[model samples]
Target: MVRNKLILAAAMLSSAALAAPAAAQNEQFIPILSYRTGAYAVNGVPYANGVADYYSLINERDGGINGVKLLVEECETGYATDKGVECYERLKGKGPTGAAFINPLSTGITFALTEKTTTDKIPIITMGYGRADSKNGAVFAYNFPLLGTYWSAADIAIQHIAKEVGGFDKLKGKKISLLYHDSPYGKEPIPMLQVLAKKYGFEFTPIPVTHPGVEQKSQWLAIRQNRPDYVLVWGWGVMNGTAVKEAAAVAYPRDKMIGVWWSGAEPDVTPAGDQAVGYKSLMLQHGAGKFLVHADIEKYVYARDKGASEPGKVGEVLYNRGMVNAMLGVEAIRKAQEKFGKKPLTGEQVRWGLENLNLSDARIKELGFEGMLKPIRISCSDHEGARDGRVQQWDGKGWKVISDWYTANQSETEPLVEEVSGKYAAEKNVKPRDCSKES
Candidate 1:
């Protein structure tokens, strides 16, 4: 009986010893709002997987960032705004620091959560989408359109079109048509496009594709009849694939139609088969393929049989972008830790880190993201640290970068950003921050 008691005590002590390390590890929580079961699932799944895999890599390889274990919980939004809000509300206050930051990944959800994040003292990260004017961080304090925004995209699109037509002056009298998803995500680029059209003296027409964008017979018929010089497709999900097919049905030149970042994934053009060949689109700094970061993910996350993506989909375009998104978040947390100690940080604390983020070229290389990211510097006044984009063309099997990086002409977009953000500040009854006064 005494021998049995000693064994029991020893086992209990052993259990406690194992539990102590886990309990002692400070945790930083990130709430992911994903749409893996909607029309956008084909495009959404890979992105969500990439984000998950990167976090897993950090935990598996580095034992978490500087010893703060990262915790991620996903909630299904189904690409619905209401569902997204519900997910945000349910997960906001979770973990130690109350969700380091929120990546809505949807413009509708970003718009809905923008005010909520401010009230909750959290930051809403909209990496290449959302309201372009939100880059005015002074007015939209909680919103960070990190890498680029729709305005930058629109400006880049026009710049590419100009290059093809010879020069900016050559754009005069040319008809540049926009084929956009009817939602806010698609329409966000119109204003900037219009501003560019007027500046360059080009004919601009905006065409809207209905939600889900499956049925577009009438729209294609109009495109066939109108025969615009260039068609800019601002689509997402299955819409992107369908658009490519519809453009083919009309016998339009695939090379003439350029899609935005959301429309440039594998799923977008694969369904169109050979029709997708020569189809061009914008790259969100990075394109499809693996880098050093992906090598680490394969080594750390996949080797452990815990990867979120499928066997061979790790280096896809959307997946790589998702990894970039998570890397930015992790870097922000690491930056925040510099000021807030080596521990889990609150959302507000993370915001400061995001604002002051400076991802230098050498640092990006060290992080194994050499060709995938540009040197970016975020500030209190400008959340969009990088406003450059590249053009890629589908070569029937995979995407190939076709053009050099084109930096958006901020001289044109800046005035609009100021005007619109000023109006938003007045309507929301929020005073814009004096960025110069901020650290």
Candidate 2:
């Protein structure tokens, strides 16, 4: 009887091993590192929902990308860096394609995964947040900052403020305070802000808030006492709403305060109620409201009750951002298939596709995201294909676009990118890649 049982177990193990390769051959695995149950859950939930829905829409509508289905597995990180790294390790080698790319939603996680991805040969896409200097693709080959970076956001914020105050020349004697979350994510825009401060002759002050950012009485008190000309908020999750409430408490004009992209969502402002009215923020590309693609999602995924999020949240800002992120990932896979065949691709092949991504205006329109994203073309040297963003302001009811699309001043940004990334390369003893060698 013992020998018979052993033989049966061995037969089952052999059958499972045979089935694994067949299953892997038909799907592309994309690992989602998400934070849906933490201090940042208010913002993280919407983004995660959007991402999952987009993947669902692709499978339901297009029958997957070129018939190769996307198999996404979510690992909750709770916005913790250590947990995020663990999630990456656990899911990086799953399925056939093996993690097309990873979007480390938190800057802290992105920083932790930067070196790991380089060694593992997996691409890390930090759509709007990450190490700003990672834009220099020569030094950071496997990382893509995508649509925009913190440096560009800071530069655009300064530009908007300068325009409001007349000009860069008028920035002289002006005081701008940065109320940030006191983390690597919060400190990301400091170097660029300091550079702009020196150039425009404005006083720059950085005030930090502790994690979770519920207690900011002292920070707001400082802002009240200083009465800076404007306040730039670099916060996430609950921190955003709390800062707005404190600003209201101190009677600071909401119109004079601006937040980064992460701080401008419905959850960020809705908590402050009427106090958040007139608050402004930088838009990574698209703002809130449904677009063409959203209609499709509503028809194919939400209406059919196959959506990942609440049907009502089909087109919120973070939701739209998630759709855009998934769209980029899918397009990269499509591009990879152009060369590597329409089958499950390795992470290295996906990297090649990401590097060569060229989404024209017509292509974007065809994909039902015409007004949602600007035409982006990535190359070996320029991983951040688009640098332009618009400004939006929250009225009593909702957000409204206030400025035309503005491009980052690459003259100022490129030099800084080179300086910082070059220093990083030297410290890590990494030899920068030569783009010319690539076909």
lDDT of 2 at 363: 97
User: In model 2, how large is the Cα lDDT of residue 244?
Assistant: 97
Model 1: residues with Cα > 4 Å off, grouped in runs: 1-25
lDDT of 1 by residue, 296-411 (tens): 99888788777776758889999998999999999999999999998989999999989999999999999999999999999999999999999999999999999999999899
What's every prediction's RMSD, in angstroms? 6.9, 6.5
Model 2: clashing residue pairs? none
Query: What is each predicted model's overall lDDT from 0 to 1?
Result: 0.90, 0.89
lDDT of 1 at 185: 97
Pairs of colliding residues, candidate 1: none
